[model samples]
Target chain A: MPILEAKNLTYTYSIGSPFEKTAVDHIDLSIAEGEFVGVIGHTGSGKSTLMQMMNGLLQPTSGQILLDGCDIWDKKTDRRNIRFQVGLVFQYPEYQLFEETVYQDIAFGPKNMKLSEAEIDRRVRETAEAVGLTEEQLKKAPYALSGGQKRRAAIAGVMAMEPRVLILDEPTAGLDPKGRTKILTQLQAFHKRTGCTILLVSHSMEDVARYASKLLVLSQAKVVCYDTPTGVFAQSQSLESMGLALPQITRIFKQLAEKGISFEDEVYTVKYGAELLKTRLEGRNPEC
Target chain B: MLKDITLGQYFPMNSVVHRMDARYKIVITLIYLVMLFWGQQIWSLAAGLIFTATAVFCSKIPPKMIIKSIKPIVPILIFTGLINLLMLDGGDVYWKWWVIRITEEGVQTSVFMIVRICLLIAGTSLLTYTTSPIVLTDAIESLLSPMKKLKMPVHELAMMMTIALRFIPTLIEETSKIMAAQKARGADLESGSIVQRAQALVPILIPLFVSAFRRAEELALAMECRCYHGGEGRTRLRKLQSGLRDYIALAITLLMFAGVIVLNAVLH
Candidate 1:
C-alpha cells in the first residue's frame, strides 16, 4: 500500500471572498513507502500548498488525503498526530526558530508529543548529531547562530520528531553551495539510514535529480506529470514550456546526443556520465 | 486561512478621493468630525449620517469595504447602545419589570448613542480607506508642522506612525508564515486547553518578535544609508494643493452643518 495517497485534492484560498483563488486544483497523487519523491514547480504552482495539505497543516477545500490507507481528514482523525507521522519543513525555516536555545527548539516537536523528558533529550541529541549540530551549538541561542546553522537547527527540530515521511519545501533555499551540499547530503544520509519516504519540493532540477527517485511536476496548481526522474527529464521540452529546466547532467547528455554522439544509456549523475565517457573512449582507442 | 486581516489596509484606486490632497482631506475630515459633534439633537445625527453616506458614495469605495472596516467597532457600538438603554432613567417610564424599567427617554438616548458611534466609525473609515498610509503620514506631518515651534518632534512622530502602519500588514504576513511553519513541526495550536493554547503561542511569538526586531534593525540601517535625518530640508514628491473641488467640498460640509442646526431649531 502507498504510504500516502491524495485523491482529487483541491484547495481554494479565500473561498467565498473576492480574492478567492484556486491554489491547488484537483491533484491526484500517491507516494509509495520509502520512495523519495521530488515535487518540482515554479513559484505559485501550488507545490507548497499541496505539501501543507498532505500533513493536515491545511484542510483540502475539497477531497481526501489518506495515510496508511486511513483517511487523514476523517472527523475523528487527530491532525496533530498526522503532523508527527508526516513531518514538513518549510522553506527558509530558520525564520521560524523561536526557542532561546537550539536544544529547546529541536525538542519542541517531541515536547508537543508529550514524550518523557529523557526521550525528548535523547531524540534532540540524535537529531542534532544527524544535522551535524554540536552540543555547544545546541546550548547557544538559536537567534545568535549563523544563518546556515539556524537552518540546520530548524531541520533538526523536525527530524527529532522521527517522522515516517519527511516533506521538505526548498530545504536548501538561500544557502551557499557548501551549505546546500551539506544539507542535501545530510538529508540523503538520513533517508538512507531511516528508509523513510521523502517528499522534497524543490525548484532546482539538479538537486532533485541528484536526490529523488521519482519526480512530480506541478503546473498551475495541478500535477502535470508523475514519473521516474529519468522519465521526467526525457520530457525536457514540456518542462521548459513551464519555465523549468532539465538537470545539468541530463542537459549535458542531451547536448552530446545533439552532436551525433549517441550514448547507449541516459546519464543523470556525474558517476554515470564518467562511466559512459570511459566506455566510449575505450571503444575508440582500446589502449588501457 | 490567516490572510483575511484588513487593518490599515489601503485599497488602490485612482478616484477623486484617492487624488485629493491628503493634507486637505485630513483637514476636511477633522472639520466634518467637529460638525458631527456640534449638533445637540437627533436631526444633527441624521445630518451627520447623511454627510457621511454622501462622502462614502462620492469616494467610490465599495460600501462592503467600509462595513468591513467598521465591523471591529460593532461590539463597542452595541455595548454603548445597551448601556444607554439600560442605565438611563428619566422622563416617562413606558414599562417596568423586576428591577428593570424602560423609559421613553432611554429609548431616544440609546438610538442617539448608537447613531453617534456608528457615524463616528463610518466617517473616520472614509478618511483611512480612501487615503494611502504614506500620504496620510505626510498629511499628518504637514498638519502637525505648526507644533514644531514648541520643539515637538512632529516629523519624527509622523515617521514612526508611517512605519508602524506600513509594517502592520508585513508583520501579520510574517506571523502567519511562522505559525504555519511551527504547525508543520507538530506544534498544535488548536484542540488544546486554555493553558496549552497559551503555551502553544510561545513557538509563534518568539520567532515573530525575533523577525520583527531583525526587520526593524534592517529598516533603520536602510534609512541611515539613504541619509534619512528627521525630515529636515526634505523635499516632497507630491505637494498638497487645494483647488475648486476642495472649496466646493468644504462648502458642502459647512452647508450640511448649517442644515443640521436649522433642523434642530425647527424640531424644537
Candidate 2:
C-alpha cells in the first residue's frame, strides 16, 4: 500500500480575490512505502504545493490526501499529527532554526510530539549525528554553526520526528557544490539507514539521478511523467520542451549513443558515466 | 494570509486622479480628512461622502479593491460605532438602561460618526490607491524640500518611508514562509490556549526577524555598492509638476467643503 497518497487534489490560493490561482490542479499520485521518489518541476509546477498538501500544512481545495490509507484532511484526523508523520524540510532550512542550541533545535519536533524526555534526547542526538553534527557542534548556538551545519541542524530537527515519509523541498538549494554534495550524500546515507520514504523535491537532474528510485515530473501544475530515471530521462525532447534543461552529462551520453556507441543504460551522473565507459572500454557489450 | 494588508498597497491604473501630481493628491486627501473631522453637524457627511465617491470614480480603481481596503478596518469601525452609540448623551431619551441609554441625539451622532469615519478612510485610501508609493514619497520629498533650508533631513525621511513601504510585501512574504516552515515541523499554532499560541509564535518570529535583518544588511550593502550617498546630488528621473488637473481637483474639493459649510448654516 502507498504510504502517502494524493487523490485528485487541487489547491486554489486566494480564492474569491483578485490574486486567485490554482497552484496544484487535480494532481493524483501515490507514493509507496520506503521508496525514494524524486519530484522534479520548474518553478510554479506545483511541487511545493503538492508536498505541503501531503503533510496537511495546506488543505487542498478539493480531493483528499491519505496517510496510511487514512484521509489526512478528515476532521477526525489531527492535522498536526499528520505534519509529524510526514516531515517537510523547506528550502533554506537554516533560517527556520530558532532554538538556543542545535540540540534544542533538533529536539523541537520530537518535543512537540510529546515524547518522553529520554526519547526526545535520543532522537535529537541520533538525527544530529546522522546529519553529521558533532556533540560539540550541537551544544553551540544554531547561529554559531557554519552555513551547512545550520542547514543540517534544521533538517535534523524534522528528521527527529522520525516521520514515515520525509519530503524535502530543495534542501540543498543555495549551497556551494561541496556543501550540496555533502548534504545529498548524508541524506542518501540517512535514507539507507532509516529506510524511510523520501520525497526529494528538486529541479536539478543530477541531485536525484543517482539516488532516487522513482522520478515524478510536473509541468504547468500537472504531472507529465512518473517513472524510473531511465524512463523519465528518455523523453529528452518533452522534458526540454517543459523548460527543464537537460544536464550536460545527459547530452554527452546522447551524443555518444548517436555515434552508435550506445550504452546499456542511461548515464546521469559523471561517476555513473565513468563506470559505464570503463566497462565499455574493457569490451563488455558497448552497444545495447 | 498576511497579504490581506492593503494599506500603502497602490492600485495601478491610468486615470486623471492617478496622473495628477501626487503632492496634490496628498494635500487633497488631508483637506478631505479635515473637512470630515471639522464638520459639527450631520449635514456635512453627505457632502464628504459625495466628494469621496467622486474621487473613487475618477481614480477608476475597481470597487472590489476599495471594498478590500475597508475590510481590514471594519472591526475598528464597529467598535467606534458601538462606543458612540452608547456613550453620547443628548436629545430625547428613546430607551433607558441602568448604565447604558439610547437617546435620539446619540443615534444621530453615531450615524454621523460611522458615515464620517467610512468617508474619511475611503478618501485617504483613495490617495494611496491612485498614487504609487514611489511617486508618493517623491512628492513628499519635493514638498518638504524647503525644509532642507531649516536643516531638516527631508530626503532621508522620504527615503526611509519608501524603504518601509517597499518592504511591507517582502516582509509579509518572508513571515508567511517562516510560518509555513515552522508549521511543517509540527509547530502547533492552532487549537491551543492563548499562551500556548503565543509560545508557538517564537519559532516563526525569530526566523522572520533574523531574515529581516539579513535583508536589511544586504540592501544596505547593495545601496552602498551603487554609490547611494544620502541624496545630496540625487537627481530624479521624474519631477513632481502640478498641472491644471490638480488645480481643478483642489477647486472642486474646496467648493464641496464650502457647500457643506453653507448647508450646515442653512440647517441650523
Candidate 3:
C-alpha cells in the first residue's frame, strides 16, 4: 500500500470572492514507501497548496487524504498526529526557527510529539548530525548560523520528529550553488539511510531528475503526469507546453538525437550523459 | 481561515460610488457619520437610515458584505445597547430589577444608538469598499497638502500610510504561511488552553517578525536603489480629479446633514 495518498483533493482560495481561485483541483496521487517523489509545476500551479494538504496543514475543499489505509480527515483521527507522521518543511523554513539554540530548535518537533527529554535530546543530536550540523554549532543560537546552516537546522527540526513521510518545498531555495548541493546531498543521504518516503517540491528540473525516483507534473492546478523520472522526461514537449522544461542534459541529448546522432532518450542527468558520451567515444575511437 | 477578514478591504467594481473621487467619498462618509450621531429625533434618525440605505444601494456593494463587516462588532453593539437600555432612567418604567430597569426612553435610546452605530459602520465600510487604498491615500495626501506649509510632513505621512496599508495583505499572507509551517511541525495552535495558545503564538510571532523585518529591509534597499527619496516631487501615475459625480455625492451628504438638523429642530 502507498504510504500516503491524496484522492481527488481540491483546495479553493478566497471562495465566493472576486479572487476565488482553485489552487489545487482534483489531484490524485500516492507516495509509495521509500519513494522520493518530485513535485514540479509553474509558479502558480498549486504545488504548495497540494503539499500543504498532504500533511493536513490545509484541509481539502473536497476529497480526502489517506495515510496507511485510513482517512486522515476522519473525525476520530488526530490531525496533529498526521503532522507528526508527515513532516512538511516549507520553503525558506529557516524563518520558522524560533528557539534560542539550534539544538532546542531541532528538539521542537519531538517535544511536540511528547517524547521524553532524553529521547528528544537523542533525536535532536542525531538529526542535527545527519543534516551536517556540528555539536558546537547546534549549541549556538540558530540566528547566529549562516543561511545554509539555519536551513539545515530548520530541516533537522522536522527530521527530529522521525516522520515516516517527509515533504520539503524548495528546501534549497535562495542558497548558493555549494550550499544547495550540500543540502540536497545530505537529504539524499538521510533518505538512503532511513528509507523514508519523501516528496520534494522543487523548481530545478536537474535536481529533481538526479534524486527523485518519481516525478509529478502539475499544470493549471491539475496533475498532468505522475511517473518515473525517465518516463516523465520523455514527454518533453508536453512538459514544455505546461511551462516546464526537461533537464538540460536531457534537452542536449534530445538535440543530439535529432541531429542524426543515436543516443538513449532517457538521459536526464549530467553523470548519465557523460557516461553515455564516454562509451560512444570509446566505441568510435578504439585507439583512444 | 484568516482570509475572511474584509475590513478596510477594497472591492473593485464599476459603479457611480466607486467612480466618485476618493476625497469626496471620505468627506461624505465623515458627514454621514456626523449626521448619524447628531440626529436625535425619530424623524431625523429615520431620515439617516433611509439615506444610508440609499447610499448602500447606489454603491452596488453586496448587502451581505456590509453585514459581514458589522459581524465582528456585534458584541460591542449588544453591549452598548444593553447599557443604554438599563442606564437611561427617563419615561415610564415597563420592567424593574435590582439595578436594571427597562423604560420607554431607555428602549427608544437603545434602538436609536444601535441603529446609529450600524449606519455608521455601513457608511464607513462603503467608503473603503469603493475606494482602493492607494486612491484613498492619494486623496488624503492631496487634501492634506495645505498642511505642508505648517511643516507637517504631509507627503511623508501619506507615503507612510500608503506603505502600511499596502503591507496589510502581505503581512496577512505571511502570517498564514508561518502559521501553517508551525502547524506542520505539530505546533498545536488550536486545541490549547488560553495560556498554551498564547504561548503557541511565539513560534509564529518570531518568524513573522523576522520575515517582516527582512521584507522591510529588502523593500528599503530596492526603493533606495530606485532613488526613492521620501515623497519629494513624486508624481503619481493617476491624478485624483473631481468630477460631476463627486459634486453630486458631496451635495447629497451636505443636504442630508442639513435636512437632519432641520428635522431634529422641528420634531424635538
Cα lDDT, all candidates: 0.88, 0.88, 0.90
Error of 2 at B179 (Å): 1.4
| Predicted model with the maximum lDDT | 3
**Per-residue C-alpha lDDT of model 1 across residues A140-216, encoded as one tens digit per residue:** 99988999999999999999999999999999999999999999999999999999999998988888888899999
In angstroms, give how far residue B27 of model 1 lies from its true place.
Answer: 1.7
Q: What is the DockQ of candidate 2?
A: 0.78
RMSD of each: 3.2, 4.0, 3.3
* Better model by DockQ: candidate 1 vs candidate 2: 2
iRMSD per prediction, in order: 0.9, 0.7, 0.6
Model 1 chain A: lowest-lDDT 10 consecutive positions: A279-288
Better by lDDT, candidate 3 or 2: 3
For each candidate, what's the DockQ? 0.77, 0.78, 0.76
The total of clashing pairs for model 2 equals 0
Of candidate 2 chain A, the 10-residue stretch with the lowest lDDT total is A279-288
Better of 1 and 3 by TM-score: 1
